[model samples]
Target: MNFKSIITSFSFTIVFAIYTINSQNTIGETEVFTTTNQAVGNITFTDTGDLVYSHHPFFSPENRVMIMDAKTKTSKPFPNKAWNTPRTTDDNYLSNVLGIRNDENGIVWMLDMAQRDHVTPKIVGWNTKTNQLERIYYLPKSVVPKHAQPNDMVVDTKNGYFIIADEGIGNGGDGTNAAFIIVDMKTGKTRRLLEGTRTTLPENTPTVINGKHLAVNGTDLLVGNDGITADANFEYIYYGPLNGTKIYRIKTLDLVNEDFTVTELDGKIETYSEKPNNGGMSIDIAGNIYLTALETNSVAVVLAKDKSVKTMVKDANMVWPDGVSYNHVDGYMYVSAAQVNKGAVFNDGKDLSTKPFYIFRFKPITKGVSFR
Candidate 1:
């Protein structure tokens, strides 16, 4: 059989296997939170247990950020409508937001790509305690290239820093350029590292979603330097490319040190075990990295001690699991399934995404890191 036929058959078999597995397992029950026809780009739980998620700008236009009531399954614009409203010349407006996380200090940090109208990228912090904007740090053009797509972020509140992944393929172009961005929380200083390096850039491999090659407009959708997370002690940052398998990490001190040369920094990078095509990632207090395995529709756990991978959960409804966040209060890892492979971006401009995108959560064996 040809590759296409093999993929089709594999997709069917995987779906059937997931159903069979879910029917047999009772320990991890996946609870789905409906998004009212909006694609959930990323999700984070507030200190009070409310769900705050971003409506992926790739497909939707209203409410770039929202807070959802778990009981009512309803959502409203977070903070206010002014920040989310799209404006051509307003510097304070939120153009596009993807990665978001709630810190222990009652602050929610959001990474705005600022792709719309070619505005500079920025990081916005909202203090949930005060229900107001805490701070906004605009990134310099040197750190965020014109075509850079800042995908995900992890905040180090204790050390006052943020690490972000730039997929580098903005507006649907070829995926070759990519980088790791480090932002100093105190000074608002931003620096780009590993730009276009083999560790940051995607391999010459096609992204297979649901066992089929994800191609749009006669080009395969290859993303780079996407999933990122920080250790519990805030000493190291872990990251991997979306289209690549190997995971890598670097010391936080080396990243922030001005004396470290690029060659020296490159030497400090430690390669971990290979992983499946993954989306968002988070590390627990025990140092285990949780990843959303997009191809197999499961959550994979990578142990810090041995760097070995194991599947935490697999379900039939996990269509293109996009982001994974650990909520300590609930003791579960929340995952957002945007059904990105089924959206218009991959379906030749025909939207195949089902309405009411889902956010699923399941309890992991290990307790999550208490960064907040």
Candidate 2:
């Protein structure tokens, strides 16, 4: 795909960096798009190669969701302009969107946290092929606690289920609570698991970015369970806390089985590997897990064959890489640098984010799990 020069000022620097990175064959980083609006939270590419991204509502309240043409690099409100606009009377409008995934079946699944305007949390599915609303599922207050901050999600298209992660940072930014949620797409039934469990909660670890601790109100903001992904075959769901280093997984069958007691499901949980403080993650068809190392501004991979971790790509410009999506058609992994650590929340109430936030792509050795 040809990337447009959204901001020509950085063209020379970006091209030189890409050429330098490509010469090494470690990983080739390319800037696909740039924006001066709200920082990008999460992104996914449709079957037709159109990019869908969420403007994290943590900083701005507009353009909650958007669709960008891969070739022209022009974006517009997704689904429709009405859904993106904020309305007090309309309950169907998107309030705050973060996690998004486009399945192989031409469906774009969006996870709305509803943290803004006190709207109800919801999941909306849009058919990319038909350009129609496929389904909408609302989460009751019983499952979404007032303190919960639902962020990332993984869709199991074959089984009609989605697993979401609640960082539980709470409205006050205290990262003490966390949970794993399972939603049945067919019935719209949702269940919360491992609520406030040791496995789900954040560790007493500080989030250091570029050798500096990220803090708010004189306290380190250690986010809880944030990144999540499923294996290529959907056999197991893997996730880890943003403030923690240990990765965990459980069989999909065990998680979807309503008859299984919490204890039984806990027994099925398996500790996978000890990783760095990370943001988003994606798995390859070979079962290798690609993770964004937030502190180092690099992508790390956990080998499926041996479970050993290795740094795949390191770029100085990938500041606070928050989300990653692997595109099979282009043979590249797309990443968003949200610069959360540089936001007002961490910069003493001053937003230090550089203008024209970036979306980058790099080629991975193996094909992505979603590749067909």
Candidate 3:
């Protein structure tokens, strides 16, 4: 109830000013789409263009997920309050979440890390069109290790699979246990793939934001395999470590095939492109990969053809641009400025983030996969 809403009328002027000040080779006019009192972790849009996002769990928000009215811009607990509320008779609440995606079938899949309560991590898929709970896919401890933090995911409804990026930062880990969890929609079976591999592990480099190395409790923040996404046809899944410089990917067929040995799957992995330390990723119909460049406070893209990386937009206000999602209805890609480096955990217990947190949008080079 304390979340105040501000309706800014001069979005064009603000975006124009930001574009003019930044020296990067920007591609589009970045507009301040909306603001929220809490830090938004990730974003997705319904078929009707309704915005639904997760509250960054690092801040310990009361509500895990929220939906903002497309017209009124009023925010409310998504899928009702009980799903967001925890620690009662109800056992089916979202403990902690970050990754959220709206699929083509009108389903919003939320990746619940369960870090808030130290419970079993799971995926909650809600039918937005029907306003009902569709399914809950639990990742047991056997599959989700103690340090596995399932951050983002790609829902391939056409192929009946959900590939998740498990950033191994949980339970005092320093990215040594990161991996991907592949879920079979039909049988709800899960597999932890590529754990501790070179592909899933962070490089021996620190993530410097604004010229300062990002660390927590005097230890460098080493998050592995953070940003992830699949191609339009679900033929390939692209991903890389948060502190790594190379983007690697493999065929979706190779990732889910049990017959392929770990070494064989690793051999099939290709270094797709180079990227800065990033948080979220979304791909376009033309195979362009939009990445949230954390260090530069800008959005970057990996061109599908040349495999070249280019800066899309840069804004000073876009500190720690965490989650990027493309909304096909609006023809713009939305991003969340998480400002994680300013969180108390990273700054000697001093919360320095300024609010209200913002979600910005810019026109994409081409049409994107609507449900990514």
Error of 2 at 311 (Å): 1.3
Model 1, span 219-314: residue lDDT tens: 787889999888888888888888888888888787767788888888999997788888888877878788888887777888666887877777
**What residue pairs are clashing in model 1?**
104-372
> What does the lDDT come to for candidate 3?
0.87
- How many angstroms is residue 90 displaced in model 1 relative to the true structure, after the best TM-score fit? 2.1
Worst 10 residues of 3 by lDDT: 1-10
Q: Please provide TM-scores, in order, for all candidate models, with all chains considered together.
A: 0.89, 0.90, 0.93
- lDDT by residue (1-372, candidate 3, tens digit) is 222322233553475456545544775668799889999999998888889999999999999999998778999999789898887565599999999999888999999999888767899999998999999999999778888889999998978999998889888889999998999999999999999899999997798987788997778999998998888888888999998999998999889999988898899999888888888898888798999999998999887778888888778889889889887677889999988888998888999999989899987666777777
- Extract clashing residue pairs from model 3: 225-241
**Highest TM-score against the true fold, candidate:** 3
What RMSD, rounded to one decimal, does every model reach? Answer: 8.7, 7.5, 8.0
Could you tell which candidate, 1 or 3, scores higher by lDDT?
3
Taking the candidates one at a time, how many backbone clashes does each contain?
Answer: 1, 0, 1
Report lDDT (CA) for all predictions. Answer: 0.80, 0.82, 0.87
Candidate 1 Cα outliers beyond 4 Å, as residue runs: 1-29, 33-35
lDDT accuracy of residue 360 in candidate 2? 81
Query: TM-score of model 2 relative to the true fold?
Result: 0.90
Error of 1 at 46 (Å): 1.6
